[model samples]
Target: MTFIALTKPQMRGLLAKRLRFHIVGVFAVSLGIAAFCKFAVAKPRKKAYADFYRNDDSMKEFEEMKKAGIFQSAK
Candidate 1:
Protein backbone atom coordinates (compact mmCIF):
# COMPACT_ATOMS: atom_id res chain seq x y z
CA MET A 1 0.00 0.00 0.00
CA THR A 2 1.27 3.53 -0.89
CA PHE A 3 1.69 5.86 2.09
CA ILE A 4 -0.17 9.18 1.94
CA ALA A 5 2.18 12.11 2.74
CA LEU A 6 0.80 15.21 4.46
CA THR A 7 1.97 18.72 3.33
CA LYS A 8 4.36 20.60 5.72
CA PRO A 9 1.78 23.10 6.99
CA GLN A 10 -0.82 20.38 7.48
CA MET A 11 1.67 18.24 9.46
CA ARG A 12 2.72 21.21 11.60
CA GLY A 13 -0.87 22.11 12.39
CA LEU A 14 -1.63 18.49 13.19
CA LEU A 15 1.42 18.31 15.47
CA ALA A 16 0.40 21.46 17.32
CA LYS A 17 -3.12 20.17 17.83
CA ARG A 18 -1.82 16.83 19.03
CA LEU A 19 0.60 18.54 21.40
CA ARG A 20 -2.15 20.72 22.81
CA PHE A 21 -4.41 17.69 23.28
CA HIS A 22 -1.64 15.77 25.06
CA ILE A 23 -0.85 18.74 27.32
CA VAL A 24 -4.50 19.24 28.24
CA GLY A 25 -4.93 15.49 28.81
CA VAL A 26 -1.87 15.33 31.05
CA PHE A 27 -2.96 18.40 33.03
CA ALA A 28 -6.48 17.05 33.49
CA VAL A 29 -5.15 13.67 34.58
CA SER A 30 -2.81 15.32 37.09
CA LEU A 31 -5.66 17.37 38.52
CA GLY A 32 -7.83 14.25 38.81
CA ILE A 33 -5.06 12.35 40.63
CA ALA A 34 -4.48 15.26 43.02
CA ALA A 35 -8.20 15.55 43.74
CA PHE A 36 -8.48 11.82 44.38
CA CYS A 37 -5.52 11.89 46.75
CA LYS A 38 -6.97 14.86 48.65
CA PHE A 39 -10.59 13.69 48.88
CA ALA A 40 -10.86 9.95 48.10
CA VAL A 41 -8.08 8.45 50.19
CA ALA A 42 -9.03 7.49 53.72
CA LYS A 43 -7.67 9.89 56.32
CA PRO A 44 -5.80 8.44 59.29
CA ARG A 45 -8.35 7.98 62.06
CA LYS A 46 -7.67 10.05 65.17
CA LYS A 47 -9.03 7.20 67.30
CA ALA A 48 -6.95 4.04 67.22
CA TYR A 49 -6.83 1.13 69.64
CA ALA A 50 -3.69 0.95 71.73
CA ASP A 51 -1.37 -1.89 70.80
CA PHE A 52 -2.59 -5.09 72.45
CA TYR A 53 -0.05 -7.32 74.08
CA ARG A 54 -0.53 -10.64 75.88
CA ASN A 55 1.35 -9.18 78.84
CA ASP A 56 -1.55 -6.72 79.35
CA ASP A 57 -3.40 -7.93 82.48
CA SER A 58 -6.82 -6.75 81.32
CA MET A 59 -6.66 -9.06 78.30
CA LYS A 60 -5.71 -12.02 80.44
CA GLU A 61 -8.47 -11.24 82.97
CA PHE A 62 -11.11 -11.08 80.26
CA GLU A 63 -9.87 -14.36 78.77
CA GLU A 64 -9.98 -16.08 82.15
CA MET A 65 -13.49 -14.81 82.85
CA LYS A 66 -14.69 -16.08 79.48
CA LYS A 67 -13.19 -19.52 80.01
CA ALA A 68 -14.66 -19.72 83.52
CA GLY A 69 -18.06 -18.75 82.12
CA ILE A 70 -18.47 -16.17 84.87
CA PHE A 71 -20.97 -14.47 82.61
CA GLN A 72 -22.56 -17.88 81.88
CA SER A 73 -22.00 -18.55 78.19
CA ALA A 74 -25.01 -20.21 76.55
CA LYS A 75 -22.70 -22.86 75.10
Candidate 2:
Protein backbone atom coordinates (compact mmCIF):
# COMPACT_ATOMS: atom_id res chain seq x y z
CA MET A 1 0.00 0.00 0.00
CA THR A 2 2.90 2.47 0.75
CA PHE A 3 6.37 2.90 -0.73
CA ILE A 4 9.32 2.36 1.63
CA ALA A 5 12.28 4.77 1.80
CA LEU A 6 15.66 4.52 3.43
CA THR A 7 15.58 4.43 7.23
CA LYS A 8 18.11 6.30 9.45
CA PRO A 9 20.37 3.22 9.70
CA GLN A 10 20.29 2.67 5.93
CA MET A 11 21.11 6.33 5.22
CA ARG A 12 23.95 6.31 7.73
CA GLY A 13 25.42 3.19 6.20
CA LEU A 14 25.20 4.62 2.71
CA LEU A 15 26.91 7.84 3.79
CA ALA A 16 29.66 5.88 5.51
CA LYS A 17 30.30 3.84 2.38
CA ARG A 18 30.41 6.94 0.18
CA LEU A 19 32.83 8.64 2.59
CA ARG A 20 35.10 5.59 2.54
CA PHE A 21 35.16 5.61 -1.26
CA HIS A 22 35.99 9.32 -1.34
CA ILE A 23 38.85 8.85 1.12
CA VAL A 24 40.24 6.01 -0.96
CA GLY A 25 39.98 8.10 -4.14
CA VAL A 26 41.93 10.94 -2.50
CA PHE A 27 44.68 8.57 -1.37
CA ALA A 28 44.90 7.03 -4.85
CA VAL A 29 45.23 10.47 -6.48
CA SER A 30 47.95 11.54 -4.03
CA LEU A 31 49.89 8.36 -4.70
CA GLY A 32 49.63 8.89 -8.44
CA ILE A 33 50.98 12.44 -8.19
CA ALA A 34 53.88 11.32 -6.00
CA ALA A 35 54.74 8.49 -8.37
CA PHE A 36 54.66 10.79 -11.38
CA CYS A 37 56.99 13.28 -9.69
CA LYS A 38 59.39 10.57 -8.58
CA PHE A 39 59.67 8.86 -12.00
CA ALA A 40 58.76 11.49 -14.59
CA VAL A 41 60.38 14.74 -13.52
CA ALA A 42 63.44 15.61 -11.47
CA LYS A 43 63.13 18.28 -8.78
CA PRO A 44 64.48 21.70 -9.73
CA ARG A 45 67.47 23.07 -7.86
CA LYS A 46 67.59 26.44 -6.08
CA LYS A 47 68.50 29.38 -8.33
CA ALA A 48 70.11 32.48 -6.85
CA TYR A 49 68.60 35.89 -7.65
CA ALA A 50 71.58 37.66 -6.06
CA ASP A 51 73.26 37.50 -9.44
CA PHE A 52 71.09 40.46 -10.46
CA TYR A 53 73.37 42.77 -8.43
CA ARG A 54 76.61 43.26 -10.31
CA ASN A 55 78.56 45.85 -8.26
CA ASP A 56 76.98 45.60 -4.74
CA ASP A 57 76.37 49.32 -4.17
CA SER A 58 73.63 48.48 -1.65
CA MET A 59 76.12 46.44 0.34
CA LYS A 60 78.54 49.34 0.58
CA GLU A 61 75.74 51.71 1.73
CA PHE A 62 74.72 49.22 4.43
CA GLU A 63 78.29 49.02 5.70
CA GLU A 64 78.62 52.80 5.72
CA MET A 65 75.39 53.20 7.69
CA LYS A 66 76.58 50.64 10.20
CA LYS A 67 79.87 52.52 10.67
CA ALA A 68 78.05 55.85 11.15
CA GLY A 69 75.50 54.32 13.60
CA ILE A 70 72.66 55.92 11.58
CA PHE A 71 70.16 53.41 12.93
CA GLN A 72 70.54 54.92 16.46
CA SER A 73 69.60 58.45 15.22
CA ALA A 74 66.44 59.80 16.91
CA LYS A 75 63.74 60.63 14.40
Candidate 3:
Protein backbone atom coordinates (compact mmCIF):
# COMPACT_ATOMS: atom_id res chain seq x y z
CA MET A 1 0.00 0.00 0.00
CA THR A 2 1.20 3.52 -0.77
CA PHE A 3 1.41 6.03 2.06
CA ILE A 4 -0.31 9.40 1.60
CA ALA A 5 0.76 12.53 3.47
CA LEU A 6 -1.56 15.47 4.19
CA THR A 7 -0.38 19.07 4.72
CA LYS A 8 -1.57 21.17 7.70
CA PRO A 9 -4.19 23.00 5.63
CA GLN A 10 -5.42 19.71 4.14
CA MET A 11 -5.71 18.23 7.61
CA ARG A 12 -7.67 21.24 8.81
CA GLY A 13 -10.03 20.96 5.81
CA LEU A 14 -10.56 17.25 6.49
CA LEU A 15 -11.36 18.01 10.12
CA ALA A 16 -13.81 20.73 9.05
CA LYS A 17 -15.53 18.22 6.73
CA ARG A 18 -15.83 15.66 9.52
CA LEU A 19 -17.25 18.28 11.93
CA ARG A 20 -20.59 18.27 10.08
CA PHE A 21 -20.87 14.51 10.43
CA HIS A 22 -20.09 14.75 14.15
CA ILE A 23 -22.74 17.44 14.61
CA VAL A 24 -25.33 15.30 12.79
CA GLY A 25 -24.41 12.26 14.89
CA VAL A 26 -24.81 14.25 18.13
CA PHE A 27 -28.19 15.63 16.97
CA ALA A 28 -29.47 12.17 16.08
CA VAL A 29 -28.41 10.74 19.44
CA SER A 30 -30.12 13.58 21.32
CA LEU A 31 -33.31 13.09 19.32
CA GLY A 32 -33.26 9.37 20.13
CA ILE A 33 -32.87 10.08 23.85
CA ALA A 34 -35.70 12.63 23.78
CA ALA A 35 -37.96 10.14 21.95
CA PHE A 36 -37.13 7.45 24.50
CA CYS A 37 -38.00 9.79 27.36
CA LYS A 38 -41.26 10.86 25.72
CA PHE A 39 -42.41 7.34 24.90
CA ALA A 40 -40.77 4.93 27.34
CA VAL A 41 -40.38 7.16 30.41
CA ALA A 42 -43.17 9.74 30.13
CA LYS A 43 -45.86 7.33 28.90
CA PRO A 44 -45.42 4.97 31.85
CA ARG A 45 -45.37 7.86 34.32
CA LYS A 46 -48.56 9.29 32.80
CA LYS A 47 -50.25 5.88 32.89
CA ALA A 48 -49.27 5.41 36.52
CA TYR A 49 -50.77 8.78 37.39
CA ALA A 50 -53.96 7.94 35.49
CA ASP A 51 -54.24 4.58 37.23
CA PHE A 52 -53.69 6.16 40.64
CA TYR A 53 -56.31 8.86 40.09
CA ARG A 54 -58.77 6.39 38.49
CA ASN A 55 -59.71 5.00 41.92
CA ASP A 56 -59.46 8.28 43.81
CA ASP A 57 -62.47 9.36 45.91
CA SER A 58 -62.25 13.08 46.64
CA MET A 59 -65.59 13.21 48.48
CA LYS A 60 -64.57 10.38 50.78
CA GLU A 61 -61.33 12.16 51.57
CA PHE A 62 -63.25 15.36 52.35
CA GLU A 63 -65.60 13.43 54.66
CA GLU A 64 -62.64 11.87 56.49
CA MET A 65 -61.11 15.30 56.90
CA LYS A 66 -64.39 16.69 58.16
CA LYS A 67 -64.62 13.88 60.71
CA ALA A 68 -61.12 14.70 61.89
CA GLY A 69 -62.17 18.37 62.39
CA ILE A 70 -59.64 19.68 59.88
CA PHE A 71 -62.09 22.44 58.82
CA GLN A 72 -64.26 24.87 60.80
CA SER A 73 -67.52 26.42 59.63
CA ALA A 74 -67.88 30.20 59.47
CA LYS A 75 -70.24 31.67 62.02
Q: How accurate locally, in lDDT, is each candidate?
A: 0.70, 0.72, 0.89
| Index of the highest-TM-score prediction | 3
lDDT of 3 by residue, 1-36 (tens): 998896655644788789989999999999999999
The reply for model 1, stretches above 4 Å from the true place, is 1-9, 42-75
Candidate 2 lDDT, tens digit per residue, 20-47?
9999999999999998886666433112
Q: Mark the regions of model 3 whose C-alpha exceeds 4 Å error after superposition.
A: 1-12
- lDDT for predicted candidate 2 compared with the true structure: 0.72
Q: After superposition, how far is residue 12 of candidate 2 from its true place, in Å?
A: 2.3
Count backbone overlaps in model 1.
0
- Candidate 3's displacement at residue 17, Å, is 0.8
Which candidate model has the greater lDDT, 1 or 3?
A: 3
**Candidate 2 — which residues are off by over 4 angstroms?**
1-10, 43-75
- For model 1, how does the per-residue alpha-carbon lDDT over 35-70 read when each residue is reduced to its tens digit? 877665633222222333423688678888888888
Model 2 steric clash pairs: none
RMSD in angstroms, all models?
9.9, 8.7, 4.2
Q: Regarding TM-score, does 2 or 3 come out ahead?
A: 3
